[model samples]
Target: MTTSDILRAALVGRLTENGTLTDAAWAKAATAVPRELFAGSYFVPIEGSTPTGYRTVHPADPGWLEGVYTDQTLITQLDGRTSPEDAGEQSVTGAPSSSSTLPSLVLDMWQRLGADAGHRVLEVGTGTGYSTALGAHRLGDRNITSIEYDPLVAARAASALRAAGYAPRLLTGDGLDGDPEGGPFDRLIATCSVRYLPMAWLRQVEPGGRILVTLSGWSYANALALLDVTGPGEATGRFLPGYTSFMIARPHDRPPRPVLALLPGEERASRIDPAKLDTWTGSWVAQLAAPSAERMGSGGNQILSDVATGSQARTVPDAAGGWTVVQRGPLRLWDRVETAIEAWQGAGEPQQDAFGITVSAAGQRVWLGSADGPGWDLPV
Candidate 1:
């Protein structure tokens, strides 16, 4: 086997072992699509970095093939503003804006989506178009419509799709709105995460269809949701197991803010462990409780800053065994976070899979355990 052949097999093998790729058809399509063609030059995030600095890898880079073949997301753009090619050889700092999502997740979501022949699909966040190519390979190019928020990214993906001998109806627009003219689709999958379930997607997909997405927040906490469309403007589904997240859709991203100041606040004893903020599920619950706050710091020195009202919550070691939390401004960030943490603990510290969402003409709610259980309203 050639290098691409061997590396491709190795990557596929890993996903198969991990149960990320299950079907024979998806496996075949993944192997056939040249990932390098879609990711001609991608970015590798620098370890222990800010703004997600990237190391560019071109087709000429000795490790380019290996990097492309690895079953991991490759950062493609930063701050939705700069590309690896634009930064030359030096590393630069900016948030990751786009990526060729991890091969495992791309295939896993596809496997769960169950799109097949005769199925018309709508894909949001085309990115590098690798995932779209996989869908095109399975359902045929004519049956799929992929939308990208960035025209430049869409154009690059479109060119690569054609070079690889496949073409879906690639368009440039706000993917959060779905394809205004393309759906009533059998399946809708978003490669990017959203703050809430977009009603537009629910309305456009046919009843009994599936919508695979991630519910993300300003705190960067995210959970994957798979909804079965029950009727017009409605759907109900549960959060799938395991950890997976994508960048927030551009339209749902938090607005610009002034530099954060971690000054003093009203000091008092904390009711919960400060380390809970580092716990995977605890952080998720905290996000659901205070949906508008951005968390910072770590361990005993954690910080929560409200994005809208500029409220602040800072934690430190107390004279006693517990933590001391300080709060400032209108909202009580730590109090909300503490309540959520207690709720989760009271519910037996359930995993992400225990969560589910119900979307209707009224609104969407993410609940723990059941539709009537502890829940939060998702901004629709």
Candidate 2:
């Protein structure tokens, strides 16, 4: 077999053995699509960099092919413009704007989506077209429609898909808006996270269709949900088991902020340990409690800055054994977080799956245990 074929087979074997590639159709599609085509060049982070730096890799480099086939997300663009070719030999630093998502996650989510024969699918965020190729392979090119926000990224993905001899309807527009004209699709999957389920997606999908997406916020905690559309402008589902995250959709990302000026207003002993915010479930709870605040720091040194009301909360380890929190502005950020965390603790500190979400004309609400339980309204 050719080198690409051999590598692809090995990847499929590893995924199947680990129980990630459960669907035979997905396995076949994984084997057929060449991932290296989409990841001709990528970036790897430079270890131990203070601000985080990345160096470029190319096909000519040793282990490039192996790295491409490995089940890991490969950074393809930085700051929306700098590609591997642009970085050259030096380390470059910027926020990751696009990537070829880890193969295992892609395959697993596709299987979890339960897409079957003749189902029309709308894919949000066609990053490198690798997942798009797999979907096209199994469901036919005519049945898939993928949308990308970055025009440059979309153009590159289109080239790669064409080279692989598969073409689905590709659009260079905001995935958050979705393809309205191509409406009533059986399934819609977002590769990016959103602060809330977009109304456009709800209206575009037919009743009884499924919408799979990750809900995230300023704090960056993510919860994956698969909602069954009960009717127009409405859907409900419980959080899926396991932790999953994706970059927040650009439109839903927090706006730029000025340098924070810490203000001290009310001070009190924290009801719960401040270190809890560092844990996965705890961080998610804190986020649900203060959806408009951006979280920073970790452990007892946590800081929260409210985007809307300019409210701020900061915690520090107190000499008296527990943690102390200082709050300022109209919003009592720490109080909201403490109450939420206490509620979560009262329920035995359950994982994300214990939570459920509902999206309706009334608004998006995330609840612990059930719909009537203690819940927080998502800042839509």
Candidate 3:
């Protein structure tokens, strides 16, 4: 067997052992597909670099093939422009715009999607086309339509898919808009996270179809949501178990912000531990409360700055007791967060699995325990 085959087998074995690659069809697809072909080149983050820096890795580099086959998300692009080829041997720093998501997460999501052999699938954010290839292999290339927001990323993915001997429908445009001509797909899966469930996806998917996506926000906390389209412009589903995150959809990402100048407005004692905002589900609750606020810092010294209204909330440990929060601007960022967190705590401090989302023409709201339970309206 070739070295590639050995690495691929090991990956499949690891995934199967961990119960992620359960279906025989998905296992076959994983075994057959060469991850390295799509990877071509990727970025390795430099350790302890301010603003985070990445160094490129090429095919000629030792352990490149092994790294490709490893179950890890590999950064492919930065700042929506720079790629490994562009950076060459230099260490560059920028927010990651594209990546090859870890194999285990990809396959696990595909399984959770509940796609069958003959189902037509719409895939968003075809970063490396690796996930698209897997889906095409399991569901047939003719049944898969993958869209990429970046033209260059799409072109590279198309080339790689061709090289891998698979030809799925590839489109260069916004994945959020989806494919108008290729409507009514049985399954719609996004590789990126959206701030709110897009109405277009609800309209495009057939009734009873499934849309599996990660719900994220300015706070950066994410949870996987699997919704079943019940009717036109409506769907309801629960947050899946376990933590899943993806790069925010480019269009849904927060707008550019000016330098923050902390201003004083109101001060109060924090109702809940400000450090709760640092936990996974707590941060998610905080996000639900202040959807437009960008969160920074951590633990006792948590900072929240609102993007739309210029509202800001900063928390620090109180010298006398627990925590104190200072707020300014129109929105009481900390008040909302504290209220939401208290509600979540009142609901017994459940994990993400206890949360579910409902979408309608009125708006979408993510609820805890049940649809009627304490819920937060998505900033739709």
TM-score of 1: 0.96
Off-target runs (Cα >4 Å) in candidate 2 are none
Instruction: Give the least accurate 10-residue stretch of model 3, judged by summed lDDT.
Output: 260-269
Q: Rate the local accuracy (lDDT) of all candidates.
A: 0.88, 0.93, 0.94
Clashing pairs in 1: 51-94
TM-score of candidate 2 on Cα atoms, chains taken together: 0.98
TM-score per model over all chains: 0.96, 0.98, 0.98
Model 3's lDDT to the true fold? 0.94
Candidate 2 lDDT trough over 10 residues, lowest sum: 175-184
After superposing candidate 1, which stretches have Cα over 4 Å from the reference?
Answer: 48-52, 263-265
lDDT of 1 at 323: 87
- The window of 10 residues in a row where model 1 has the poorest summed lDDT is 45-54
Order of candidate numbers by lDDT, starting with the best:
3, 2, 1
Model 3, clash count? 0
Give the Cα error of residue 12 in candidate 1, in Å.
2.3
- What RMSD does each model have against the real structure? 1.6, 0.9, 0.9
